[model samples]
Target: MNNENIIDIIYGNLGSMTATDQKVAHAVLTAPKDAVNYTISELAKVAQVSEASISRFCKNLDLTGFHQLKIQLAKVADDESSYYDEINIDDVQQALTNIKNNKVAEISNTLASFTTPTLKKIMALINHARILQIAAEGNTYPVVADAIYRFNQIGILAIGAESWSTSIGQTLNLITDDVLMIISNSGESKALLKQIDVAHKQGMQVIAITNRKDSPIALKADQHLRTSVRQYVLNSDYYFSRVAAITAIETLFLLLIAENRKRLSAIQNHENIISTDKI
Candidate 1:
């Protein structure tokens, strides 16, 4: 079996292993490729187990400390037997179930690495902004649109305009009190970057949701919510990261909305008062 298969076996039978082996097994399962590059000491520390236990774990797989285990795993990862191409047609239920699992894993990882300070900053931005605008292009548009909807639901002066010129027009009177959240997976969209530059120049707080941390949009944004996606060819039929990015945006919006629950309730109550007065 290939290293991935072996890793799966290790994961599956983890509870059966000795307590020390379980630590090593968990580390490998979480990040097999990264584990290959770690030294014995590094791996042992990461696994929270001793070096001697690590060597014993490798021996369980018929290898030596860190290096030989890495070589074997690398060979398996590089081998053709481990490669699987996307199948266009599949049973709908099976496909959806697997996709759901993938999304859960991606969000879990994203949340784990998420910095608390970043979240606190985003929440502060939402709380203090006079207006919040979400702008996006291509598939990213859906995420921004949803954010705008959430903002409106809570009576925030939020806007998400689809067309390029309209968004620019809307931003003409922008001030530092405004905040802009831009969503782009690739972070290479020229128009979006230009708009972000405009917002920044006007002293607005710009937040970027993108996969590319080093992309121009990220550099220009006042804040960033970085998401990780598997690199694939441009023409690749099945793109897996769209949902992950969307989930990140949704999470951010939910957090912001939840944080402002009292304010939202007050806004609704005022609107209700006005409606009753008119009636």
Candidate 2:
């Protein structure tokens, strides 16, 4: 019952949340430690909402009551406060240990954030689409390319558009039967946002895989699959976001193959042909 899990739940549900609930969520996210200490009445006052709204918010997050939320928040506060307290960057062993721990935590958090119903919807869209296009830029481009490769290996028709103009051109031709899967860690890239706008206006459905569920691109897409994990280290020069995003993409690829025998057969056939040619 880590509050990080609760925080992820709040973010994952932000698209469908009421304004009041959003206020409560924001208040907690901004200062989880403080929130843990606040009575329901204090939190209500701080968030500028009624106590009933706070109770409803807890229930929405599947917590039985406000007390349970506080318990989770207290644990999270303790963990967060101590997460980096012992780290010594000059010590190689300590640095490597810290890095490994952070990566493991991030992957676990990303996995906990996934919703089965949303994943099923994404699988269904990919299965039924007349065409599947992936849009991404910068560091995210490789992930999109990998997804395209994986889909093609299973006999699924998929393409990747990495540049702004290419994405625009690809999205322009997309019809209602086509699906565009956009990968962006921040989900706020100017280029991707433009394409998302075009895709929506052109009557095409969009699926967004991003770290921030509340980001503009996620909000614009027809369905959003969120990746939980913030970038870490070295003045933001190092990023762990890709690890989580790629993990999600691979999970989808595996699930697609699992649910479709034809896809698996296609992959096996391709392998067999390659083996025979090599022989």
- In model 2, residue pairs whose N, Cα or C atoms come closer than 3 Å (at least 3 residues apart or on different chains), thus clashing, are none
Candidate 2 segments whose C-alpha is farther than 4 A from its true place: 1-72, 75-89, 235-240, 273-279
In TM-score terms, which candidate is top? 2
Worst 10 residues of 1 by lDDT: 79-88
Residues 238-264 of candidate 1: C-alpha lDDT, one tens digit per residue: 243666577776777678767766756
lDDT of 2 by residue, 83-141 (tens): 22224578989877776775665567777767899989999999888889998889778
TM-score of each: 0.62, 0.70
Clashing pairs in 1: none
Clash count per candidate: 0, 0
